[model samples]
Every structure is written in structure tokens, then in C-alpha cells.
Target chain A: MHTTDTETFEEQFAIEQRLVDSVVASFDSTTDPRLKELMQSLTRHLHAFIREVRLSEDEWSNAIAFLTAVGNITDDRRQEFILLSDVLGVSMQTIAVSNPAYEDATESTVFGPFFVEDAPEVTLGGDIAGGATGQPCWIEGTVTDTAGNPVPEARIEVWQNDEDGFYDVQYSDGRVSGRAHLFSDAHGRYRFWGMTPVPYPIPSDGPVGKMLAATNRSPMRVAHLHFMVTADGLRTLVTHIFVAGDPQLERGDSVFGVKDSLIKDFVEQPPGTPTPDGRHIGDRNWARCEFDIVLAPEQI
Target chain B: MHTTDTETFEEQFAIEQRLVDSVVASFDSTTDPRLKELMQSLTRHLHAFIREVRLSEDEWSNAIAFLTAVGNITDDRRQEFILLSDVLGVSMQTIAVSNPAYEDATESTVFGPFFVEDAPEVTLGGDIAGGATGQPCWIEGTVTDTAGNPVPEARIEVWQNDEDGFYDVQYSDGRVSGRAHLFSDAHGRYRFWGMTPVPYPIPSDGPVGKMLAATNRSPMRVAHLHFMVTADGLRTLVTHIFVAGDPQLERGDSVFGVKDSLIKDFVEQPPGTPTPDGRHIGDRNWARCEFDIVLAPEQI
Candidate 1:
């Protein structure tokens, strides 16, 4: 479309649309069909968004600068882009789209940036609160197939922040805490000792925090424990269990990760209750929760 | 909207929609209403795009990496983000949206990154080809208001790359060439001697270039001269005059800066025609072009 010296608004809009089409068509020679399709859709949607909002040059420049800052602050320990996606709910949306609902299977959530490979493994009923400070809590869960049959020897990786809301990586001293891997017993039952989960704010000292502040939004995730459960013939599940009564849950998770099934009651046990391993009861208070995970069949 | 253990596709979609709504609502407390509105619209559109495309985790990671590379390559001397926007047609779209159609006024284009402030000032008919090697060309233009009345004493800033297709900033020797500022004569006419405009590829040693190559798109912008004309009571015009009949014009410009009205014929004159100032027309051939710029009245 050729724009003349005197163009009506409609004509100019059409010219812009044609330009979008031209950009989309430029991807015709892309060798990867998926990339071609993605690029075309992205161009169309991005242009439409710009036109819809009448985005100004100053706003565009601001966005570029904001994105650049996000990239600049990124490093081995921090994934600001992923955090941006999480706060925007795009990560959860992608998870929902990629992992469709299966009958009685575990719902997946975002695999946050803190997962570490080769977490120290523990036996069933072992404590994973190494060098961590918090109220002791017993986490017992079962791993089973959709048919309710036991899936023995499944690997369960659990990670969370300490009571002070600091992850192991966040510590300047390079201390490891509040994260470990364990295998389910022959009865498909796994239990470990951990800290009582607490609501915590995501890192907010960077550009993303500035964005959240500008938008009057909080950068807090609900109290929760992250879990990645993997079995021999089932789909791997990365999910989280939220503390049922955490105020942040009602306020809505910043990452959009709170699902109804994933919320569990962290029952406070009185000091007189007997321990699961026949240990003597102590005056210290503790919490207990039981979560049963169901895995979907792996595609052939 | 909470998701249960059993969710139909529609139910899951509703959940995702609710997540989007929550995010949008989170911006309700934004102090700046315009920013709040923009954030809401942007969040909705961006979430919708992700849902429509069903973007996968791997694809999302790829996008993050690509944007990081683009940001990493950007610096004072180079702006890869702007290049990315230009290639995607966003910069042009923003210009079109920002500058609406004005009656008989010069249409604006992108102010490319090569523009340097405080360029050497020259007389109405001075040569701006400083320490540059190229076939000589004469550019003459008149500045007029919308009613076709000449506006005298207008400031005109002209800049372009040398015949080698490299802007002054792109050189390593720290030499300045092919750019200058001049004022129009009493008759609102201005003329200058410089290299013949030639099509040139944008810097392709960055991530934006990789994107272009991957998408099978060219990095060549159409041959053109950059101009910024400003007068006392008239709106400033940032635009380009494309050399007509250039092959790249038909192929589409990399920056989407070309417009039908901005195209002008650069007529070739074999070594015989007298120069504009009656300078000796030696054995060297030259070209000539006339561009008339019209400025709009500045709004109060």
C-alpha cells in the first residue's frame, strides 16, 4: 500500500497493516516451520497490540530500557526474565497450555529458577532441613499412578525458603539449606522433615520490582513448597503445595501458581502427640501435612 | 477461580482468564492513570497472545535468550533494540501513529541512530562532504508552509553515509564525514553538495542481524538522505528522501522508512551539465535531486 501526501486515517491504518503483513511474509523462507509460524503470529499480535494501544515513542523507549535493565541484572543466580514471566502469569499460562488436564493426575506449575541438580538425597522419613532454621514440620506424601496403584521408588525433589524467607542461593555465605531429594518407599510413601512454609516476597530490588511498584502490585508468592516428582512410566510433574490458610493465598499468588488441589492444611500438632518414628514426645511444637501425588501415563 | 482435581478444557481456560483478570486488577492502585491503563491493556494483550500461540517453555526460553542478546549488544555506539524494532516494523508503526496526516506537510520517518547533534554548520550552498570520497551529487530543497508559502531562515540538518555505505560513527578512525547542518536562504531554498545516496545494509554483526538472517530477510535500507527541518512557528519534520528507482525500494526497506511521496528521482548527468554554482564540471559524472519540504504549524 502506497501512502500519498494526503492520507485519510483509514488509509494510514491500512498502510500499517500492510507493513505488518510484509514483515510476516518476510519469514516465509525460515527453514523451521514452527519458527515461521511463531514469528508470523508474534508479528501480527505485537502490531495489533501497538495499534490497539496507540503506543507512544516515549513508552516504546521506556519499554526497551526496562527490558535492557532486566537483562543487565540477570546472572547465574537470578533469572529476572523468568521472574517477569511468572509475575505476569505467562509462565503459569504456558504451563496450563502445555500440560492439559489429566484424570486425577498432579497439576503442573512453574519450574521456578531455584531448582538445583543433584540435591542431596535422603531416605524415607529422613530430615532435609540441613543447616536451616525454622519450626520442624513433617511432610508425608504418596506417589501413585492415575489408577491409584503405587508407583514405588519415585524421586521427589523438594525445595523451599527458610523461615526468614531466604533460599539457599540467596545467602551470601554460600550455605545450603531447605532443599533435598528423596525416594518413595516400597509402599509409595515418602516423608521428610522441613520448615513450616511461610509467605515470602520475591526479589524486588531490580527493574521488575520497579515495574511492580509502578503498577502498585506486590512481589510476594504465597507460602509453599516446590516439588518435582518423577517416576519410571509417568509424566514428570513440577508443582507446588501452598499453605491452605496463608493470607497471600487469598490475596492471589504473584506467580499465579495456587491451585485448589495444591493447597493443603498444615495442621499444628500439640506438644503431646507421639512422633511418627516412635520418638519421645517433646515440648516443641510441630506441623504435619500429607499430600498424595498422582502421575499421568507417559506418551509412547 | 480455583481449579479442582478435575477440570475440563473450558474450566481450565476460565481459570487462565481469571488469572489474567487478577493480574490486570493488580494495577488498579497505580497512581498514574495513564500508566495504569497502559499496563492493563498490555497485560491483557500479552497474555492473550501467549494463549493464542500456546507458546511452549522451550520457545519462551529461546525468546528470553534472544532478547538478552539484543540487550547485551546495545551500547552508546549501537542500539540493537532499535534495530530489532525497525526490522519488526514497530519503529515505523510508532512513527506513523505519533505523527498523523497533515495537509501538504512533509511526512515524517524514523530518526535513525546515526544522527549526531551539533553537526558542523554550513552556508546555504556549502558542501557538507567533509573528508569523504564519493561521486558528487547536488541536493537542493525549499521549505514551505502548508499553504505553499516559503518559510525563510529554516534550519535544515542533513546527514548520510558515504559511498562505501558506512556512516561516520561506524568508522574506527574517529573521523566525521557526510553530515552537516545549514540554514535556508531568504527564499526558503537550501542546497548542498554530497555523495550520491546509495542503498546500504544496516550493521549485521549483532543479534538483530542474526534474526534477519534466520528469518530470510534482508538488512538493506533503501537509498535515502536524512533530514530534519525546523522553523520558528512550524512543527519540526524528521524524514528521509528516498532515491527513486533504487532496487531496494522495490524490495522494501529494512527500516520501513520509505513512502511514495518521499521518493525523488536522482537524475544522472554525464560530465557536461554545469554545477548549481557554476563550478567546473570536470571528467567526473554527477547526480542531482530536488526535494521540497513542507512543515506544519506547531500547535499551542
Candidate 2:
């Protein structure tokens, strides 16, 4: 006759706590209470998530494979895994959860996968289109405090896709780059000529793509422009302003970037005299869009 | 004046869903139901976990660092990351949550990190323990059916630490290099001479070690014998039997391998007649323990 003892799921979870306690007892000199709390909380949640899922061998192996692929696809230029997070809404969710805005402050959105340092500084009213192929538009925007006073000299880092649906940094020619760092003028007003953004597809050639493919999904993003607005005594706001009438607007993006308050209509403007680009603007259909941003109280 | 739109968390979650939907909808051929389900569920849980944590920039960076360290420590002979999982209970939990045992079956335990594939096979009654460093004992056990009939020719892989707490596989030449593979005799009895296991410390020179140190935990494991038991018409069982009175028993192991049913007492055995190892009389202090295994039925 065989004798046996059965251990229940609760017993197993309790066993986990004991083991964790033992492990935690070994720390030497980490006086950071916040770090300790973070580690403990992370361990608890990670353990609980494992128990709740009842994860299996094949499943664990596949997760390892997915992570391996995420690393493999990451390089200097692109971060496919971060893009994965963005598309999955983790990035935006994190932004929202950590940076809740004060009433009347500009809301934050995803800092998409393409922001870079060293974008060439451009003067006020300098066109950012860089001869890129896209719909010609005059974009004017203001930065203001919650009290409606103009906050002059606010920095705006503007970027968007070209008519061909690609960033200048994504190409070899280094021309037609869509990024311009400009300061708000004395009246908190800024205007620059640019080509209207076209809908673009997030890169789909990695494990994130395989994951999306396995789920029967698309990779298209809606028309939008990324903005980073910063000023003294206020927290920086990372956000995107999307075009109003893009088909993908109602459909939304694969990256959770659309906000009703951030969308603006683009109205056609009568043509004017051509600038120095040797192209006469009066003959072409021109468009105009205006948006104003309000800053939030700084956290630190 | 700023225009405002009130957005609910549900609305945010819906927008997140639409984003993932767009990304997933472009897939051409995803016929595997399991893969399809896994992809979507992984995305959903991952999204939820991020929101639940409200992960911040530094936190995210640290997470990346932790995973990178995990990958860096992984190698062919030593999978530190797998050891990390074993310590964290993920490995055992993965197996256990999926493999519920029926009545009369032996329980499973963590497959510790020290398994080596090149064990030398020996016949029944062989001196698997090649040295006198450990307390000499003959391990005699039977493999039997749930009805108590002997299971002939069953394969058993036995490995343990010497009295000084070191495995043969762990050192190039340690006395009582406790490792042996033996088969059951015609009557289903198997015997091997080996020393009594002593408590041993797990390696503490990696990220897992760092984590343990930070948590204020010990690195010692309870005395135990590892076994891989198998027979025809029965599913394979990988398990360990722990020494009953080891000090590490009270606090449990950092790896959480102590199961009540798998704990056994190691009693002092009386000497027998002259054995093959050249001892004239049976006057030496020896240890004795026994373990009988029951296996799950095969599918066909």
C-alpha cells in the first residue's frame, strides 16, 4: 500500500512566500526603502501572475523565444520591443498612470519609438517639410498657461511622417527630415510650413510582428504629428496632435495615440507667393491648422 | 481658453483595444487556434500588468537591466536564469500547475540546476559511491505497480552530495562523488553504495546571488538525493527526497524543494559481512534510507 501527502495550491503559494523571505534575508546593505519596496512588490506580483496563469512548459519556452526575438530585433535605429509596447498600449498606459494631468492641463500621450536627440534647431517660421513629399500646410500653434497668458519662448520639438509615410531619419539621404526644434515667439505663437502627415505602418518584421500576425491584426498608424513642449516652472508634456479627417482616425492607430482633444481640422487656404524653394505656393492647394497647448504644474 | 473632453478609463481601454486590433487585423494566415489565443492573451495580460504597475522610466530601465543580466548569465553548462526561475519557483510551478496527479502517484519537485547528461550506467548492487568520504550505505529500493507488484528492469538515475556536501559532477575529483545510474533487478530491487548527503550551498556569484543578497536570504540547501525514475508503461518522474533533520528544513530552501511526503529519515545501519570494497568486518558506521516510487500510467 502506498502512502502519500497532497499539497494544495495555497500550500504552494505559502511555500513561495517562505522561499522569498529566505532569499530576501540575504541582502547586505541596501538602505533604499523605495528600491526594497519595489523589489518586494515586483516579486509578489510576478509570483502571483505566474500562479494565476498556471503557466506551462511549452508556454514558458515560447515566452523565452519571444523575448529573444525582441532583443534580436533591437538595434541603434529602431526598438521593435518598445514599438511592441507602444502598439499594445503599455507605453501610453504607463504614461497616463504615472503622469496624471491637472485639470485644464494638456494631456500626455505616447512618446513613440522614434524620438531622437540632436534634431537641427530651426528659426521661427522656418519650414520643417525640408522639401519632403506631403500635403503643404501652414501649422500655427500657441503655448499658454492655464490662466490663458501666453508662455513665450516655450520650446517645441515637432516631428511627423512624410507623404511617403516615412521619417527622414529612416532614410539614407538624410534629406526631407520631418523634425524641427523651434521656440514659441514673444506672443507664445509659433508658425511653420510643413507637409501634412500621411498614415504610416508600424514596422512589422520582428517577433512583435509575428505576435500581431498570429492575432490577425494590422500595423497601420493614423495621421499624426509628435510634439514635445517644454517651459520653465512646468512639467514637460510629451504628446501627439493628430489630423482630423484621416480614415484611420475613427479606426484609430495601432499605438493608442489618438485623443479627441488633440485632433484638429485642416482647412484649405488660398495660395500665396512662393517662398525661396523655387516653388510657387499660390498655384498649389494650401492648408492651415492651429492648436494651443497648456502646461501643467511641474512635479519636481 | 482650452477645450476639454472627459475620458473614462473604459474609453482609454477601448482605444487601447482598437490600437491592438488594427495591428492584429492585417494578418493573412493564422490558423493555429492556440497560437492565436496565446498572442492575444499575452498582449492583454502584458498591457494590464503595465497599467497595474504604473511603471516609471527608471523602473523600466531597471527591468531591462535585470533581464539583460539574466541573459548574460545563461550558458550551456549553467543556466543562471533557469536557476533563477527554479529559486523563484517558476519552473516547479509551471510543471505542477499543469500536471495534477491522480491518487497513488508520487509527487514531483523542482528539477534542480545540476543535472548532467553523461552519467555512467552501472548494474544493480554496484558501488555507485566510489569513495569512503560519505557515510557508506546501500540504497535498496523497489519500483512497483500501485497493486504492489515488482516492476523489473526499471531505470533509476541517482545523484547526491558527499558527507562534505559536494557532488562528483560539481568537482573534478571530490571524494564520494555521489552520482550513479542503476537498473532494478529481476525482483525489482535496486542497490547502490553511497554516502549520506550533507547540506550544501548553492552558487552565489550571479544576478540571482545579487537578488538573494539584496533580500537578506541564505544560499544553503537541505540535504537531499536527486532521482530520475522511469519504467515502461509509466510516465517519467523527476524528483528529490530530502533528509528529514537538516537545519535548512525549518526555513525551507531558497529554492523551496521541501515536500513533506519526500522527506525521509537516514538511520545508522549495522555493518554486514565483508563487501567488495575490501572491508573485512561490518563495524563501520553507515547510513540507510529507502524510497519507493509510483509512476503515472502511459497513454499508449
Best by DockQ: 1
Residues forming the 10-long window of minimal summed lDDT in candidate 1 chain A: A1-10
Off by over 4 Å in 2: A1-53, A75-80, A117-120, A123-140, A152-155, A158-182, A190-195, A250-252, A266-289, B1-54, B72-84, B112-140, B144-209, B217-233, B265-289, B298-300
Best by TM-score: 1
* Residues B134-224, model 2: lDDT tens digits: 7776566788766677888888888877676666655645333467788888888787776677788776788778776766667788888
- In the predicted model 1, the residue pairs found to clash are none
lDDT accuracy of residue B179 in candidate 1: 92
Tens-digit per-residue lDDT, B176-263, candidate 1: 7889999988888989887789999999988889988887888999999899998999988989999989999889888888889999
Q: Per-residue lDDT for A116-178 in model 1, tens only?
A: 777899888777788888778898989999889998999999999988988898877877788
Q: Top lDDT: which candidate number?
A: 1
Deviation from native of the Cα of residue B265 in model 2, angstroms: 4.5
TM-score of each: 0.88, 0.73
**What lDDT would each prediction earn against the true structure?**
0.85, 0.70
DockQ of each: 0.42, 0.25
Report the C-alpha displacement of residue B191, candidate 2, in angstroms: 5.8
